[model samples]
Target: MTLQQAPETVRVTAAVEERMVTPSLSVQGVVSGAPTREVRFEGSAGGAKQIVTSVAVAQDASIAFGDLLATVSGVPVFLLPEGVPLYRDLRHGDSGPDVSAFQSLLTRLGYLRGSATGTVDARTLTATGLWYKAYGQKLPESEGKPYVAVDHFAAATGEGTVRLGPTVGQRLEPGKPLFVLSAGQQAVTARFTVPEADAVKVGTAVTVRASGGASFAGTIASIGPFQSNEASKEQRAGHDVRVELSLQDAAAPKEASTVSVTVGGQGRRGPAVPLSAIRQGSQGTYVTRELEGENSSGTPPTRDVTVAVLAQEGGWASIETNPELPPGAKVIVG
Candidate 1:
């Protein structure tokens, strides 16, 4: 009689006893700077066409408080702290947040003493005159009274560099943006499918990889509403959600560039198995676990254990079984 042949042994991989598994979705993204506000010309040209006389800073130059932005028709345009637009001219005895913010600027420059009282007092006027003098400009005057003119300074929020919009010899229009102030911080923007949006949220950690193999840690700063593109014969309509990521302790690409972003979903700690090992059957999701001893047929014994998939990531799946699958358990993957 011929000897009975051993049954074929199936391929298997060890199930991770316990670990945190988090699913990650990769999507294309773009790097950009955070824009705070657009600096606009708020001065009335007094019926005369406002013309850019000279440019003090170049395009993409770093500007700060007390920095001259441009010269318009022989009047210097200085950059100042963000506040209510200097609608009307400010002079001694004017009291408001605008006046207070200006006074604070003067104090910071050592042109004014003590805290800003929100009132343009004698000291405030003196400081203003000194500030203009320091920049080689005469204090603007109307009716023989020295005052801060609306056209002399532009309001910019945040502390960062600015991008000049107006060039020398360009006509300046009141209420038109002259420059854009950026917060000097870099951020990444990307869109995710609607299904993936449910797993991603604000403050979710992500990995950003730029061209040339550079990578950085980032966090989800904001989530936008769902958007859909109009469907056409060539392409099917789809919905997606937008997300912005703030780079942490790293400089992003200077110019706008394409990047790859990997966003991780919430993690769960539990027993896990190779994603390939998970199978769906009549009883539901389950995995085939190999037994320790061989069966009477001389083949390895195995049984299917029903499991609830909690999370999956990186080729592994976290699962829950009735009888907890212990660490180092062998599971059939092939």
Candidate 2:
């Protein structure tokens, strides 16, 4: 008599899911700079011996046109209400592009009248007096005549927050950086090793999170050339690639601050399962499912199903199958 053996119960377990995911890469970076600049205050009056006697504005002060920045040799150096930098001194008789530009600014500001002739005459002096009076300063009459110091304004273009470069009781030499202006816009820079050079590209969207600060979004603006240097005694060689990011959000961390940069891996979603559920064999990568009904041999029947990997993250593999997988379909893990 042939004895029939009961079918052996085979048990396998696996975790499954149907969730959306986006691919990404994360790296470390630093805040490079702000959109504003640290412009140096040049000596005005085109003289070799200009000295600063007093500083008017405090650190983190908002600077504007006609605002007194410093008092040089008892002369108030006001912020000019113009965009272009003053490259030369303008007196009562100077004529050039600078004079024309100054004349035009004064004319537009209602401080001067008539066309800009690029020549400083009585009209220019009258305009200068009006400008000084408007700012509550005495009409500057150095050497017994109305004059505009070449470095008269000691101002920078663009209104923004200011950082004092020189302290009070300090002298501002000619062509020295007197203050730094924060323009409110900022950028971040991240460096990647040689192995990661190809992965970093310009225009790639990135999420930047500053240390102990709010998170912001940016795009890779530029990638610098490769550089190699000697490492340590044991590790001889190392390479690096520099990446600059232009941030869209204004509330950025301070410059030279460290931040985290995440880039790449976007636009993919599907059913996710344990990585073990994915099997690689002679046929290719696939998953298996045990048939509900048993074979004549009284054993569970199984079929191999092909699948394409969409993404892998956090021990889960997102996949696409030829035949759609049901929401709760059982997949073999081992």
**Best model per TM-score:** 1
Model 2 lDDT per residue over 1-334, tens place: 9999989766684535677645455667777765675555666444655566777787767776656777776677776644644576567778887888888878877888899898889898888788888666776566787677655566665666674445656766655666777776467766654323343466767778878868786777767654434444533222232344444334557778888887658656667667677775567567786666789978667788777666555656677644545556777876
Question: Over 4 Å off in model 2, which ranges?
Answer: 1-18, 22-26, 35-38, 44-51, 62-67, 79-94, 108-114, 121-123, 142-145, 155-161, 191-257, 262-334
lDDT of 2: 0.66
Error of 2 at 313 (Å): 5.3
lDDT of each: 0.72, 0.66
Cα RMSD to the true fold for all candidates: 9.2, 10.8
* Candidate 1: clashing pairs of residues: 17-327
Clashing pairs in 2: 23-265, 44-151, 45-150, 89-150
